[model samples]
Target: MEALFERVFVETTVDTDQDGQYDLIAVYIKRPKLDEKVPAVFVANPYMLHCNEDWYDLYDVNTNIQAYPSQNIQREDVTFYQKDPVVCPKKEAEQIVENSPYPEPDPSAYECISDLYGHLLERGYAGVFSGGLGTRGSDGLTMTGSEEEIFAFKSVIDWLNGRARAFRDKTRTVQVLASWCTGSVAMSARSYLGTMCIGVATTGVEGLKTILPEAGISNWYEYYRHNGLTLPAMDWQGDDLDILAKYCFSRALDPNDFASIKPLFEKNQKTLQEGEDRQSGNYNRFWDERNYLQHADRIQASVFVLQGLNDWNVKPDQGIRLYEKLQELGKDRMMLLHQGQHIYTYHLEDSPTLGLIDRWLDYYLKGIDTGIQNESKIYIENNLDQKLWMQEEVWPPKSYKSYRVQGNGNQMIVDDLSQTIYDRKQKNTKAWLDELVLTQNAHSLSFDLETMKEDTRFAGRAKVSFRARIQQPTAILSAMLVEKGKQVRLTPNLDGDENHSFVFKMEEKPSDYFVITRGWMNAQNRLNNYSKEAIDPDTWYTYSFDFVSNDYTIPKGHTLSLILYGMDVDQTQLPFVVTEIEVDTASIVCDCPIE
Candidate 1:
């Protein structure tokens, strides 16, 4: 065992000035007898090992180390002691009495337990612990100040410096990897340590309720309750930051305490809420600004984020915002948005998701250079077609072309073969136009496209433009894509009011050659925003609706189709409209070009 054990000794140093110190160190220690050619791997949890019990158990069994029971034991071989059986050095023990600034049974007492555990585990190539504040009290509004919190956070820098020492002693290299959770303490620790931190966060909402049987309040709602009110079923609730502010206000036991924290909390909550409202109906507000992306510009370590677009607890855009901010910061980072809800991405399949996490660790902690550095990828689960689309680039690729709807008197064609309009009174025209306004039931108008000569692979934005006059003052136009011949509805099944034009944006997937872009205009506001272009009498003001891009393969000899309606069959409420629908060919453009 002695021969197999690496001759590495770990020590720690502190740099109080914030200057980069003990930098450019390897992440792991290697035995002299082992091959020097392989790179070392480093892993850490700033909190106690119990916080990550599964990982702790795995590492203990793999390394053949004796697992510590929940209770502590006094053993010289065990460098650290657990909180259940407190241990203190003789000299520092006296300092607790002479110089202690905290009240009796100090909130920081847990630090001693954390230190003892860390000291024992310091023998390993890596360390792990929790760094964030723990929620206490029945309402889950109060935070506990434990010794473990301080040790978990402070020990991150300590461990990094120790790993550097271990590398120097072994004549090798070392890396520092940290993981944590929660918003306040985790972020606070990250700001102080200036090291790479990885962890999952919850906005206090349960995303599992989306697919699971159990239903609970969303994090936003919890936050709202903490703010002394419940969310109104219908109303534009400002922004993400505003919601968070409301929560903070509710949670403040003493409104004057930590007064500085309120403004930032409010601002972040509103910003996150607004962005989320634009993309999804889920009440979970997860914004990168207050969590991961706050210090993104200064982070030197590679960041990897995994999130779910369909997660009802955390807004998917939080991951996107981080990815965008990382790109802007010119940092080495990667983000993966899967077709899953919260916590589902951790499961393994024939094609495993955990395998991806392994690879990410291999590249970052082991410095293996797996060629994933400085790249971004998005995996969109097409709810419309039930397929996945993987794109490598920034958000909303600029290459997407915006196709316009053009056609008058019914038979619509997109390609440049020929322009022909069909009138009920005319001959030689293929199809006739029928204008039906939706008054009571949702009205639908379908158009068949001309046959295609070859397979067309479209990649980009798709939009619908039409002239609409509502019988009532206000109306909503709901659009959807369907199969040309089969007339299949290609929209995802969702729960909510369909009359809202913004609700249409939540459809993560739409069929190829089919799109639904909705418009809500009151009859009093019939005048279109036609300042840039002239409106032809033949065509009423053309209103454009944007849809999520569809990377669809239209088979040869098949036609493209579009459906316009006032309401979805599944929706409770209905839209009112008077429609003269026309479909036309429109150019599609991407949001950004891929390099």
Candidate 2:
């Protein structure tokens, strides 16, 4: 076992902080001891290798030692962060300390990724793990999803393919190379690690044969913010790259590594600060660099994307939107959407999804005739029945019916515009449902659509449109699709800080009923995402936005309910604005494809 694995640091060509010195990538390798070259699976992550926490439960800590050969890289360039003692403020420093319970682990220690590493090795495949730019023992400042970070990753492939230079130490004292690599690399990981894989795969780097990204982010903007709205801490939230990079790289328990890398860490703070405009929460050049789908045409590798339809953190839109672009470009791709949250389906109990992934990697990485290419391009799991799976040629049901419901105060007609005034007291505090259920509350409107005569499934993004006018400069538009029947399917659980506790928890709880999908939009972001359009006091404006996408079936005889609220006190911190919505019952519509 000892002979099968080795760890080393590969120097990347990109100058992360533009200090003229190249960044180094710390990597762990495990492969067969046989004399045959093998395709490698590269796991590029910023957490495990970079963070203080040691989650990789490999061997007993007492018995494990640093068996891999390594060299001490000396730092010649110094920066402000290295010289400064208090780089982070008291509040920011406390946040990192409170969340991370584990003490810092030694970077020199060689620990294996218990299940994933060994499983691939047993299958005659080599595996590599490298901390993203500034994480772990790697050199340079960490910028999450930055061009520099992605290029650093590309450098790793360059090294494996004999296109780049690596070293044994900073002195360039000894040169080392990937002598045993076949150069056909596949990247796979979940969440942030998975995002790195997709980010680099967009470069179309040679030798990157395929990628399997699970719950990976294709666009950084969509991951942390919606169309133009910043996501609350409860759903999808993260700090700026500078803070996050420092959180991961600065807490160096290894005194030597910290001393050498501190300057680079401080240099990163300036770049990250200048790079992102966190306050605007709008799409710009900054996010464009982080969006991999924009450069999907450059990808030379096959892609297998995994997403959870119910995931609110890194929502399904991140993967599905990218999948659509790849499909349009005639790229070879496959997708699986399940009824899970932000999780790796392969790790689920007795999951057959794991076998599907194995066959995918085998066909592309090993050049095996697994017949995976002949299989359907999309696999969708039923929310109600985990055992039931449906295979399709494309996502979002190519042929489907559209249902439109218009609701007035008295009745909901199929095509009539309804006029209603929503004017709840601006200063009222209550639960989201309690406010909605109180029909007397002028701010909320609940509509009961016609019951389903037969079972119907809506597959794809839901579009809600209506003509509305608000009294204030800004207002929040929130729509909730509820399935009211004899039983409930989803159980609503509240979690997170006081500001976001109003959101329904998507996981763990069980019930017969559940909200299908909810859509939220700020009144100002209606016309242009970057600029705000003022309302003409009482004049109505037609507004439409997509709710999160979903593929769910409504049981027969169930009445579909549409609940609209002018403002959610729980989600927004600003003062409430009363909203007046005018609709010829038919003018208001909740359009969804019936699959």
On TM-score, the candidate that comes out on top is 2
TM-scores vs. true structure, each candidate: 0.39, 0.79
For 159-187, candidate 1 gives per-residue lDDT tens digits of: 33332122222222332122110111111
Measured with C-alpha atoms, the lDDT of residue 577 in candidate 2 is 26
Cα misplacement distance, residue 9 of candidate 2 (Å): 1.9
The parts of candidate 2 lying over 4 Å away from their true place are: 1-3, 50-114, 232-243, 250-267, 270-275, 347-350, 398-403, 409-441, 488-512, 566-586
Q: Residue 581 of model 1: what lDDT? A: 32
Q: Model 2 compared with the native: what TM-score?
A: 0.79
